[model samples]
Target: MKRRAFFLKAGLAGLVVGNQGLTSCAPGPKLYGDKNFYINKGYQAIPKLKLSKDRIIKETVGLRPFRESGPRVEKEMLNNKTIVHNYGHGGSGWSLSWGTGNQARNLVKTTDAKKVALLGCGTVGIATATLLQESGYDVTIYAKDVPPNVTSNLATGTWSPSSRVCAEEKATPEIKANWEDACRFSFRRMQMSLGLNDIIDWGDEYTVRKQKPSGSNISGGHEMFHIDGLNPEWKTLAQKDHPFKADYVRRRSNMIFNIPSYLNFHLNNFLIRGGKLVIKDIKSLEDIDALSEKVVVNCMGLGAKAIFNDEELYPISGQLSCLVPQTEINYKLATDGAYFITRKDGIYLGGSGIERSWDTTPNRQLTEKWVDVLSDLMKDMKG
Candidate 1:
């Protein structure tokens, strides 16, 4: 009895010692060559990457700077070094990174500038900047706001971009071919990681379908649904197991992302590899043309309307109500013009499409409405 008691006491002492040193010894040296490596053996994902990786994804919010016409990714009105315009990605910036970034990157291969200047620091700008930096050019991001500060982070990103690309008239087959390349490329890039890149994820996408919804026919730059078609560029929703939102609720091959994870990973990657950022509200071309003499990557997003004077640019605002997270609600839904997504600590509930709702302010009325509607849906789920 005494021997067992002594051994138990010794084991308890060892466990206490191990735990006691955790705080002081945590965040230890690099392991197995991965810079942010650690030996956390049985560590479960506590809550969400948003809180755990706070240093990487500094902030969260949303904005709108899309173009009425498809993404303007070709050389625009410019001078000096070769400028590959890569902005106005609408809602699919992360979803179209490699695909679109490659298009812009292709325009500059023949004329490799010593340095590159990317205008915005949102997803579109960051992806463009990162690709350029990776290709051995000194890259600088000039923007009024940076990651966690920009609108890209504000969105509850899904893998669907309805009118993100403009109509057939605006985005010619040639430009669309470039756009397709951007899509496939971005998808491929996501394939490279082991799931730590939170800004993007591979999961089932469920948009509650009612009827074959028509996309925005008029070009006021507003879009609501991208939830049909077989073999969609990303993936299509499943029509087999339909939901009440429509006659069919299709399960598609798609993404459910935590934007914070995406921002922090790339932001850290950029900083680690020696990239520069300047926070400047560029009022004119003269300001940028005067600041850095590098070949500029015009990833201005919606800023091009004034700075680049492209009237095709417009706004499409999206709003979501955040509820406490429930893992059971792992899937996402789009029913009766509303969307419900289960992200980290919150279940994003929303669906508001006021044509001229350019305001980014949260709508309390809309929030209340969605909450009531969602509560009814929850009951329906039970019924």
Candidate 2:
């Protein structure tokens, strides 16, 4: 998940294919496409991906709990018990999972209670439980559904926090510090987590452009926020260095988590480590307080709209169409609205964010539209 939608808003141009030519291949950022020159090696992907209606193994939707004010990570008392909220990262849910989980765990520490209840078993819920358990607390996850079945599985699973996290003007200065902390912690965890068939790895990402997008970094309905440890500059890439048929190209190193495997790893780890999971559809906030754990952490994502009655939180509906996996397709390419990434599970082609659209049913027409856009971009490659 290169977060093209957010990058387009930030007007972030190329940075992946260094400042040198494709032939020299130095380590520094460079661009070289003034001539019609084309290098022939290390620049080819298995062209002509088979993205068809029949090839679509599964189509899932996730309603990003987007809030104009930013994610909820505060605590309040209800029914003589403490309930800590930790939801609403919008498209950055998977990316910010561990960091936000740590943030929630920090809140849990203020209370002397050692037993905690986690609501929702998606990325955030699971992460929160793992952290709490590691901190020597008795933890149980209460959710209507678990991973491989939750909305978290549908996430593109890219490490991009500023991807619709919040508007700069709307976010308080403290939220920015929190974002940095969460990002740094999560990045370190990803580096130390299971890798090489475990669904977490470093991958190359390309942000291809037809022309420089119109907007300053923070203007034009877009936002450009910086993370402390990550590189903000996108180096230019000549057309000869990359495969896409775009006028300008930028590249960067990105951390990627294959959703299906990543979720499975977390769930299995939590269970094997003595964490308990209870499958119960909570009917109300009072229902949570009735649970055995004294402290309840709400990680309900979009469900909070009804569960907690927070009107500011809304769904940013997103859908991803996946093709059969091609292991050689290791990198990702993102244009205006469409993006492509390949993982062990499948080659992913996506996506669209329709505000307030909660339809989980995959639209064949929308899928086809993205497929066509990606196909046309790759149609020029020789491989």
Candidate 3:
């Protein structure tokens, strides 16, 4: 089948596409008590996102490993081998990789083994292995798949530490405290990696709303465990200060990752540091026992649901429709249940969280919905 026909048949024809310029909408008349009056200083015009089916490069699906009680960072003994559990970060796997890696490293410190085997090569596994290597442990990563194929590659690549990390009722005081530590540590680590081959950097994100926000907008039970400073505060923009057509526009600076570059950099770094990567499928505990290393850190993400029999672990499926990279559209935008983030590889449009879903198949209807939402917003912007 032809690429264009395939996309059109998959419902890409619903997308509104054109050269829509992002001129600012006219501001309301100034009033003495009005705080939303147009301001010129610090105002920057946003460029229109040229969203089209023709620009779409690919669509991907990822199953986020969600556990009701939050991530498992504890340790246990399996077949006399030290097994440190470090999986289940839900949608925040990439965002909280380093912090969880630190927790896993601490667990390994209790063991006498200098060589460690890491299961899975996703964000968590790679991050944990890299930390272990830096801490003087010879590490070998065993995984069924690597980057560009792993679940982490399908991530939106935004820094959202608490998104679907745990259920609100399960977020006990102890969990909140531990999560705060992880979030803070991870945020610092992400900031430290800025400007290194453009793997990570800060980008402005705008959240447009048709009505004024009356309460917290944080979703996926994140508001209960919101970490101050680590979670950047959103500043509500005045009508004339932004280009969005919505009544309420809020902006915040957040860390964004170029997944391909970021993963490649870490993977290459691990290889250079004498880290071994074995392509192996671990089906059961006995498979891990067959390894030479006595200490194993399980960073299998959703795979832990079967291997470790974690009843609380399940999948929260998400999908991303990637378009050709737009150099002018550097900033991210979120509105009407859809978001757009421009990375070096592509401009990713995504926003779907279906809990308890193990299906990794990309939904054409959902893809069309996202494109419709984003293209509608773009078309409303003045030319």
Q: What is the C-alpha RMSD of each candidate to the true structure, in Å?
A: 11.8, 14.2, 14.2
Model 1, 1-383: lDDT tens digits are 99999999999999999988985788975535322222123331112111111122112225556665667778753555556788776766667766687778777665746777788777777777788788888888888987666777777766554445554556666656666667667766766643674555555555444465566432122333332342333334353323233454445455666776777788778878999988888889788778664577787776777877777777767776676555644566555645666666466766764433567777666666765665554433311
Question: Each candidate's lDDT (Cα)?
Answer: 0.62, 0.77, 0.84
Stretches > 4 Å off in candidate 3: 1-43, 213-215, 218-224
Provide backbone clash counts, one per model: 14, 13, 0
Backbone clash pairs in model 1 (N, Cα, C under 3 Å; residues 3+ apart or in different chains), count: 14
TM-score of each: 0.73, 0.84, 0.87
State the lDDT of candidate 3 residue by residue for 279-309, as single tens digits: 9989998899999999999999888888888
Write model 2 residue lDDT over 215-241, tens digit each, in one string: 565111133357644644566877667
Best-to-worst lDDT order: 3, 2, 1
lDDT: which is higher, 1 or 2?
2
**Top candidate (lDDT):** 3
